[model samples]
Target: MSISDAKVDVVKDLKSEDAKWVKIQKVFYKDPNGKARDWEFASRQTRVEGSELDGVGILAILEKPTGPEVLLQRQFRPPVNGVVIEFPAGLLDKNETAEQCAERELLEETGYIGKAFSSSPIAFCDPGFCNTNLKLVQVSIDLNDPRNVNPKQQLEDGEFIENFTVPLKEFPEKLEALVSAGYILDARVQNIAAGIIVARKYSL
Candidate 1:
C-alpha cells in the first residue's frame, strides 16, 4: 500500500483525569493481514499525547574569574532510586519560552542566577518517550551577587540537592567517570554532553 493510502482505524482517549499536564490519546491502525495473522500482528495501539510544555535545560556552569570552578549539583532522583550528579533542568509551562524555563530551573535547583544563554532545541534530549524537546541554557553566574543565590527557592518539595563548584578543566574527566560508573542516566548524560559541545562551539 502507498503511504498516502494509510488510514487510522481507531482513536481513544486513555488519559486519566488526574493527568493534568498531558492529554493521552490511544491510536489504532488497520491491519492489512486481517485476523489470519498472529495476535501480535492483529493491530497496534499507543497512547499519544501532547503536553503544555516547552522544553528547557541548564548547563549551569559556574566559572571563577581566574579560570576553573564550575557550579554543579547532586540530587536525589526517586525514579532511579538513588542520588545522581546532574545539571538543573525542567519544563516550560504554558505561555513560557525555553529560555524562561531554563532560568527558572537553574535558580530553583542551584540557588544561583547567572546570565542565561540559550541554544536551539534538540530532540536527542528526550528519545524514549514524550515529544518534549530540550534546549541548552548556559548560565554565567556571579558568585558575589547575593541576589543571585536563593536557597529557599533553590528546591521544591521532596527534592534534596547538594550544590558544589568543580574545576572547568576537570569536567570532561569527571563526566566520563560518572557515566562509566553508571551514576549518569541517558537524558542527563546526553544533555550535559550537548551543553559542553555548545559551550565550546559558541564560547558561551
Candidate 2:
C-alpha cells in the first residue's frame, strides 16, 4: 500500500515518563559457562507490520551521465540532538516484504522510486544495546526514467528529511565531509561507504 493508504494510529499509550517508542527492562540469564548474568536492554513497544526486523536501509544508486551516484538523506535525529547522514530507510508495514518496504521507503523518504537489485542478510543494528535489526537493500534508479523527472516525497507528519546524491567515486569523501560538518553517520551508510572504497581499490 502507498504511504497515503497506510494507517498508523496510537491504539494505546503505554510509555513511561522517559520513554516514547522504547521501553527498558532488565533480565537475568545463564551464560555459556553457566554463570548468572544480568543486563538491561531497550525494546520497542510499537507495533510493526511485517517481519520482526526494525526497518530497511536502502543503498539507492542513480545512474547519471557523469557517474553512478548514491542517494543520501540529512535529517535531525532526536537521540543525537543533531543532524544525521543516512540512507533512506523506514520500518516495514504489516505483511510487507523487504523489497516492498525498501521501495516504499525510498520513495517516501527520498522522493525516488527504486527497484531492488539485491538485499543483505538480516543484520542487527546494535546487538549489545537493543534487539533492533534491519536489512540493507541495494536499489537501482534510472535517471532518464520519466517517473523520476519531477518526483515528489510523501513524508509523514512531523518528518523533515532532505535528500541529496554523491557520486559513487566520491562517496568516501562525502562521508568525511558530512562528519566534518558534525553530522552523525548511520552505521549502515558507513558500511556502504566502506564497501564503495573497497570496490574501487580492488576494481570490483
Q: What lDDT score goes with residue 43 in model 2?
A: 73
CA displacement after TM-score superposition, residue 65 of candidate 2 (Å): 1.7
Q: How far is candidate 2 from the true structure (C-alpha RMSD, Å)?
A: 6.4
Q: What is every candidate's alpha-carbon RMSD to the true fold? A: 12.5, 6.4
> lDDT tens string, model 1, 1-204?
322233345556544453555543444455686634222111112212344345666766665677856666666564455556766777666666667778777777776776786565564443333445566666777766788644455566756666666677667667777668755444554555567778887998
Query: Could you tell me the TM-score of candidate 1?
Result: 0.62
Off by over 4 Å in 1: 1-53, 122-124, 149-153, 179-182, 190-204
**Clashing residue pairs, candidate 1?**
62-71, 108-154
- Model 1: lDDT of residue 87: 69
Q: Model 2 scores what on Cα lDDT?
A: 0.83
Instruction: Give residue 35's error in model 1 in angstroms.
Output: 16
Model 2 Cα lDDT, one tens digit per residue, 27-122: 899999999999988777554854577778998999999999999988877665667788898887888888899999998877787899899899
Q: What is the lDDT of residue 172 in candidate 1?
A: 64
